[model samples]
Target: MSELIQTYWPMIVAALVLGVAVAWFVFSTSRKTRVTGTSRDVLDEGAAPAERNKALIDSAPAATPMQPAGGAAATPDATGDDLTRIKGLGPKLAATLRDMGVTGFAQIAAWDDAEIDRIDARLGRFQGRIRRDDWVGQAKLLAQGEDAGFAQRYGKLS
Candidate 1:
């Protein structure tokens, strides 16, 4: 029994040491790689590299005017005012309104609070801001073709 114990003791010790070494290595590696930045860090430091890269890509001049895959001109209505010119209307919301046959501010101006709420729901977190921003008043001014009142009313569009 003593002989057996002596033989296994060294093995047991080695195994324990190996486990501790492995655990330490894993823990240290994870700590080193973990993101340490807080939300304030991001806000204070400006946009991250990935976001800057994306903005650069989006703003890069096109090599050639993009044509439709099937060779169509891809011309949207040239006359109607772009609803996306409004303060809170993003590309997605503009596309949504366009899909709903809402090409201009007139369509939006016609929408009641309930309808606006429904539209705002599609925009996720922007709903409250959009509602409070007096989108209807801005839309009404745009629909009426009055420019002078807009700046005083909506501040800036973009």
Candidate 2:
């Protein structure tokens, strides 16, 4: 029995060590793969760099012509108005209007139906909002720089 134990002791130790190493390797590799796989799943699958860049570019406002160059009226400087003072206009629409070169109450108040349609068409998701919210009337009142009527009618200043 002692001889048998001595003969097989080293082999037993080596077998135990090999088994532990294989188990450790399998578990570690599976754990790493699971972590990476879950992280990949959490990331946006459709969000390619080119598509994301294109969406950003598309969302960016284009440079709009404010007034005719060298025409009858002198072009207004690029300084913009706070179009948000109009009751219905939030900051986003105000920024969009400013991007479209609509910087003053005079410009908005002066819009005829055709001009309104043209501008409204440019308003993207805000189409028909001008007519619905009476933006022209609001502009007319705001252009005068007196808010008495506007406040009475619109309930509050923006």
Best by TM-score: 2
Worst 10 contiguous positions by lDDT, candidate 1: 65-74
Which window of ten consecutive residues has the lowest lDDT sum in model 2?
68-77
Clashes of 2: 0
- Residues 24-128, candidate 2: write the lDDT tens digits: 999988867333344432247764556666788879575555552222322335775678888778999988777666778877877778778877887898898
Task: Tell me which residue pairs clash in candidate 1.
Answer: none
Candidate 1 per-residue lDDT over residues 1-158, each given as its tens digit: 99898989989899999999999999988877566765554445675656876788889674442222222212335565677778777788777666544566766667676666766675666667567767777888877777778877777556
Model 2, runs deviating above 4 Å: 1-62, 66-78
For each candidate in turn, the TM-score is 0.47, 0.54
Query: Which candidate ranks first by lDDT, i.e. highest?
Result: 2
